[model samples]
Target chain A: MSTSTTLEEPKTGTWDGGNEPLKASYGKLMMWFFLLSDAFTFAAFLIVYGLSRHSHLPYTGSPEEFQFSTEWWPIPEKVFNAFPGFHGVDLPLAFVALMTMILILSSVTMVLAVEAGHRMDKNDVQKWLLWTILFGGTFLGCQAWEWTHFIVGTEEGMLLADGTRIFGANMTMNQYGPPLFANLFFFITGFHGFHVTVGWILLVIAFISTVNGVYHKRGHYEMVEKIGLYWHFVDLVWVFVFTFFYLI
Target chain B: MAAHSDHSNEFQQTGEIPKAQTKVIWKTFFILVALTAVEFLFAFTMDAGTLRNAIFIILTVFKAFYIVAEFMHLKHETKALIWSIILPMALVMWLMVALISEGSYYFDSIRNYFN
Candidate 1:
């Protein structure tokens, strides 16, 4: 699945051969299968998230008068209110909304690049892939910044089950409502961030290949389409992540 | 026409985007943006409840489907390929519902056992 299909199609043959089974090339069919398994992995993670979320009581306190309780899940809007430029502003969902927009935009560029590849237009592929890589990189950078703030903890801090004041999040403890809440945040978003980083590297390599006429030499640009599939899945996963972690 | 743009010969390399296709792509982008904005509006204005959670999950699923169908070209693929991917996801979604519904029971049992 990592490499592109190098064999040219058997132009107009009686048997479609093993290569074109199910009306898709071997590479594409394999990519879809891989994506299905990946989807299962994510679904399992998120289902666990949902379970952990419902096990705890809801945070009944007002966001303005927010206080963490060991028995309730953290109110996300209360916990994730810190925006980049503004201090002490009650701007919940602002930064995450921006992150989601950036990722969705990158997915668009990736689709454009794939569209260009289908046309065998090398220059357009290069251009759109450049934009996709830029957006992906920016998203990774934003995630890094968000993680930094999350680790450093809020200024007011949170009360633990022990009645001790703690700052940022760690494995066993956090200022957030449940240690599980913060733990899931790290695992889910960190896992997605790792995907974005890998996809960005792949996009850069794909960009370089577009520039060097690698696909042109091979007489097809199916590689871009394959990578586009991966890139879009990354974007799709983030949509779920943003919904689960930030919004609700 | 979109078909011509899709199958333009190797000699036609002006780096021009397919106009109709670009329109569709931008339209999808705006739809996603609008959906996110609505989620934001709800986040700020409405208090969180089962209703809000349902709306968010439904909207998120819609966005996810749109991306897979359009961006990943799953809609363009054959029906066999499509169902093979979606059916299992449907089952997984069912599992999600089943497990989450049992969560309160799990919590109760664990609390009882511990106490």
Candidate 2:
């Protein structure tokens, strides 16, 4: 019955009997753990990329010297240069930068939604959530276009020593540096994209719930807070992905 | 799940997060944007090599810090919760650093395939 009292501020320590060790609710702590595990999963994928990339010979030449080959790993910017309408004009990493900006903006809106929820302002929460969803949708659209461009390859393609014309990247061969390049590209971005898609779904559900006054009726908006944590984690992962996958 | 109860199974939305918090949010947003701009500048202006790569990773960590600490409110959390998440991630980061350090060493041997 003493644990039922909310007057005491729980501090950092073990869960002896009545105190929250981390000063967090059971659910929020578990959510943190879930995100930690998810971080490991992403770390695993990125580590493999690190190892694979290092094991190959990197293309050390200038932009003009750049060419797709299995013998060397391509510069990521060079490989990801295709922007939607600007065909033949080399705009390296510009579109992916836009994608990064969009995701960061969504993350901003998400935190705003969490803040609005803290104020117990249902309309504000709904508005911010909708904006966040819009940003997330835009990021996903950019990713779809990027994937299409990579898969479709360029106009000239690549000439192999074996007299094969490889148009795009695939499991067998690619116009890019190596099959592993395409493999990791899809696996890494695909997994991150899947997280964004799920985050969008969760955002919609939270938005609908806010519209229906679920949090208002329940007298708390901690649902928004938890989802905010997850959404922020997604953005956090993108920061690393941009560095490791794109920049490095 | 009222804020007044500690034994609740779920976290209750508590006190006003201070209108000043939005100021902090916008400040962080600008910081994130500025850091990203610096990264893009480095990407184009700087030559490709170990130094550039190092700068990129460091800037990325800075962006990650703002997003995690400010946007996720992890900085405001209790020490136990903060360390619980950060320590493991520190190890993961260590693993990355270790691998990247060895990357150059690995590169010398692998380039022999083409040479």
Which candidate number has the best DockQ? Answer: 1
Candidate 2 per-residue lDDT, tens place, A46-136, comes to 9889978877777877867888888888888888887888979899889989999998999998998888877777778989999999999
Q: Which lDDT tens digits does candidate 1 get at residues A117-194?
A: 877778888999999999999999999999998999888788655777888888887887778988999999998999
Instruction: List DockQ, one per candidate, in order.
Output: 0.43, 0.37
Give all TM-scores, in the order shown.
Answer: 0.88, 0.88
Docking level for model 1: acceptable
Q: Mind giving the per-residue lDDT tens digits that candidate 2 earns over B1-115?
A: 4567443224334664445258888999999999999999999998889899989989988998999899988999999789989999889878876876687678786657588
TM-score of chain A of 1: 0.89
Chain B TM-score of predicted candidate 2 relative to the true chain B:
0.69
In angstroms, give how far residue A123 of model 1 lies from its true place: 1.2
Q: Give the Å error, residue A139, model 2.
A: 0.7
- Which 10 consecutive residues of model 1 chain A have the lowest summed lDDT? A13-22
Error of 2 at A6 (Å): 27
